[model samples]
Target: MAKKKVILFIVEGPTDETSLSTVLNRIFSSSTVKFQVVHGDILTRDFTSTSKIITAVWDLVKGFMGNIYHKNDICRIVHLTDTDGVFVPDKAIIEDKTIRNNAHPYYTETQIRTPKPDSIRERNRRKRNNMGKLQSCRHIAGIPYSMYYFSLNLEHVLHGKTNLSDWDKVHCAEAFDLKYGDDPNGFIIFMQKSSFSVCNDYCASWDFIKVGLNSLNRFSNFGIELPAVSQTR
Candidate 1:
């Protein structure tokens, strides 16, 4: 028997894996579905920059492939990321001294309130440039690659809320898993019919997200990647 090719998913956290892994595994049952959790947004990480983003991604794939899988064993790479209002204008960032800590930056449809507004502005600049670079990236380490976004975040897109606490994230993920785990096709249908789902055209979808405050609003192009199934299915 031939070995099943791997469809590796790169995501920022375990909650992403928890929320979508089972449904993805079932959707692409002919191949092996695996997730690499990078713990934080790779685009905004201290060690990464726009110029080094491709190499940084290559390193991530290499690290995940260590000793166990050959490059040829992988079918494709799917990178899932949160927009976090990265493309918003600097004026959309408001300084709120009452925010108390730098770790939590409050996000809304029109503005991001943070104690460190300048830092948030800088972070947005870096992340926007990095995302533009990644969007144009077609391949990494000789494997096909594509990146998708959940804005203002995965929780916002999936659960209709943002700024969720760690416990809330876990709870929402579990609920999502239960809803879609057994019926993978149902998950695809939901994505396809969602208000946040972008057009099927990949370039057009990315283009839509970068305009105005759309990045701060709920939007995702992920449904474009799902396999097309007949309505009768």
Candidate 2:
């Protein structure tokens, strides 16, 4: 028998990594496909600036690119990131389409790790401007690894809730355990009662996952596939 291909996944954090892993496992339950989840860094204020994010992602993929371009065994790659400051409707710094469209193979990779303006104001200005261009979503250069960003935040996307206070997220986790018993689909349902943003988020994720899943199922690779974006709401 031929060896199963390995699918690589990059996510912002462990919890989201775990969530995405579970969903993928459920989707590919019948296969012996293997998955690796790399802890991706979020480029928001907490993770430094856009330059750092770009450098970090470039470093990860440059290694993979060496192999992916030459090898036939590596199947695909999926990148997941929370729109920490991007999709905050009330305070969004990045546009939705900008994030979604960042993934494509045609764009040139820019060198942004160089020093920025000396003035803090200028540094921030440049950071904000450059972030809009890439959000450092450079994986589009990757042949099959699609760059995907979450709406608002991860918990909100996963739980289907929004404007969530830290306290609310903790409470929702408890409710998730009590009510859904760790069923990801059930957790998606929980996202429904959330804000409008979250509803949109669920739909966005459903679409991405559905496409990737179809590819998986067609080739016998993934899916316990979720419902259509419309019905999911």
Candidate 3:
């Protein structure tokens, strides 16, 4: 009568969480599945050492598992990290002793390659450039939607035209929120819609956060109790 738990681990960031959660929910919609997606503060400290990040993820996973595994139920953890500009592997490196390592290689990665200057002034300049492109297009309406599309357009411009496929557009809109500036809902939607949100060919990083929140919504609608990563905690 119990549900199977699928744990999703992510680095700190509302945008990232949204994308992963959305995809997981979309993938596992059956009644037999239960998910526990935790957004961690892996990037809080310097992630220069990959070992530290992996260790932190391991600790979080072990702590999340209570005394439920003995009841013939299994828990799986899927870790999603951002590659940024660095070239990390697409596969997840899991370190659980008992479990077959990376049993389900949902170990995914995203890139954040922004060639523009990191300084506030330069960053603003880059944002302005992207915004201008979005404003020129009329595919969507409303200021909020316009802003959202503009921001994404900027990403596309920086990375080159990504051939915004139908599915990609649908997910992208859901992934990036124009209303909430850095809100994660839109990104989560992107993740749920697209198999992969952010990759080398394209940089749709917002989808992860959007997708994750979507999962939470589905779980709540089904009356399923799940743990949330509270900011205060």
Candidate 4:
């Protein structure tokens, strides 16, 4: 009876699109929410030296909306990117020590951060500088944008079940189990049945995602309306 929200999921690849769509659809059903996937380009760059996120995201947004236009109909734009090289292990550790650090995979730094730890003042300074450089893409034509980043890459988010040989494709949305990957419907069922909340393994991003989804109209129109909203950060 209520109107559905139009959400544009700007994902880096189809595999992401597949899993996310499947999960969200199970939660919101096919009627109360409509999802449109707009594929984005991953910039070719020496990522260790510089972050090309702004350039890549800008291309995706501008390509869709063009130079000047109002986007009131769109409920929210959720941009997803992976933290692939965020905390690469020291080469010598993997080579000589042969014992890699697990903290690298559990990297919690989402905002601009120094390569190594810094004093509070220094950290703030670098953060400000990075923010200023990124302001152009951060605020885009007044269109609401929220970002979701996967730590250590999407495969790691899949609990290292990255290989295609590990999973089965579900019937509806090509869903794959984020953890096991052997059962394609596992994730979708979990999302649909439970009051889904933040997962520690997801690298502290679930609440941010809730805020983005809340920006939409009637976001709680159907099943599992805004679960774990109270547990949001």
Candidate 5:
């Protein structure tokens, strides 16, 4: 029998893998669904720039292949990213001197509060520009590529909460897996019907999140990429 082509998912952290890997595997049973946990937001990473984003993604794909799979063995790359309120205006970023930690930035629907507002602003500027470049990127190193967003962050879109500690993130992902692991169709339905699900059009969904404070709001374009049940098989 021929090996199944891989459908690679590039995600920020392990919790994302924990939450969706099994369900996505079940949904895309015809292909091998694999998760590449990038450990941090590549879009906002200090070493990444708009010019290097595409190559960075391609490098990730190659890293995953790692002599085990050839480039042709991969069918597509689906990148799932947190919006992190990156598209919000500068005024929406408030420097709260009371925030003594200086490293932890907190998000609200209207603003992100932190002691290091300038750092956050710079991160946001880079993220916004990099994401804009990524949005138009249809392929990386000859492999089909598409990107999706969870506004504010994954925990917000998936669990209606944010600022979760690592333990909380794992707990929530496990709980989410328990709910959807055996019901891929149900997962699809939930993605489609959720209040956070953006419109079905891909471009429109990205546009919606970039407008005003919508990036800080609960929204996802992932549902737009979820394959229909019949198509999955």
Candidate 6:
């Protein structure tokens, strides 16, 4: 008998699929479990408005195992977006309507505790200018943290330096016009470099993928193989 296939769907971003693939292959190396990971091109601030991407993902998953296997097969779809105070509404739409018909599980999210859209640019610019001063202060204070989170050059709810609480909303990474855009690739790097990325929803999705793949590896039927080449970067 042929082995069953599992489809791992992800939202488009800088987060390398290679990491997920590598982890999956390792867990299922001895098992017959097979997985085909695909990404949905829903990268950007406009992702919430792009209902086409949602429909496309549903169509693909629906065709994979048909409605009959919908409840049986482990097809899954995950989306990561900017919370920007809009995550609740965005997720509600996907859960209640957009992907409600999808046979597989569907999820969406946004960054948490990020600077609001209106202030991200100014904050980044201020951070860039104050890097020298902040680095010096880090030595003096014997603690290292970016001054962007609390600086007069940037906006805040309090005087002198402001923390996360004063902001009215968080902005999507893309809105900052950062070098890497909002893709997981850049987000992953940012997550690696700063404390902020840990709070973001994108990393959470990646972590979940790791968990799902690990679970699937134990089920002895899918033939999973590692990627021929590992990450050099």
Report RMSD (Å) for each prediction in the order shown: 1.4, 12.7, 19.5, 10.8, 1.3, 20.2
Evaluate residue 191 in candidate 1 and report its C-alpha lDDT on the 0 to 100 scale.
79
**Model 1, 80: alpha-carbon shift in Å?**
0.2
Off by over 4 Å in 4: 1-5, 26-56, 65-70, 89-139, 162-226, 229-233
Over 4 Å off, model 2: 28-58, 61-71, 87-142, 160-233
Sequence-dependent TM-score of model 4: 0.46
**Candidate topping TM-score:** 1
Clash count list over all predictions: 0, 2, 31, 0, 0, 14
Ranking by lDDT: 1, 5, 2, 4, 3, 6
Query: How well is each residue in 67-173 modelled by candidate 5, as lDDT tens digits?
Result: 89999999999999999998999999998988766776888999999998899999989998998998888888888899999877788988999888899999999
lDDT tens digits, residue span 146-219, model 6: 11111111111111122223132123222233333323344333333332222333224223222322211111
Name the lDDT value of residue 128 in candidate 1: 89
TM-score of each: 0.97, 0.45, 0.33, 0.46, 0.96, 0.26
Candidate achieving higher TM-score, 3 or 6: 3
Q: Which portions of model 3 show Cα errors greater than 4 Å?
A: 30-53, 63-74, 88-233
- Kindly list the per-residue Cα lDDT of model 3 for residues 1-233, writing each as its tens digit: 55654433333334333333443353343422333344432423333243343444445544545665432333334333322211222111223333232211121123222222133223233333332333233322111111121112222312232334446644554543333234333333432333322322111322322332221111111101122213111
Worst 10 residues of 5 by lDDT: 224-233
| Predictions in order: lDDT | 0.91, 0.41, 0.31, 0.39, 0.89, 0.28
Runs off by more than 4 Å, candidate 5:
229-233
TM match of model 2 to true structure: 0.45
Best by lDDT: 1
Q: Decide which is better by lDDT, 1 or 3.
A: 1
Q: lDDT per residue, candidate 1, 1-233, as tens digits?
A: 99999999999999999999998998988889999999998998884788999999888888899999999999999999999998888899999988866787999999999999988988988988999998999998889999999998788999899889899999999999999988887888887778988957999999999999999999999998898756313
True-vs-predicted CA distance for residue 8, candidate 5, Å? 0.5
Query: How far does residue 157 in candidate 5 sit from its true spot (Å)?
Result: 0.9
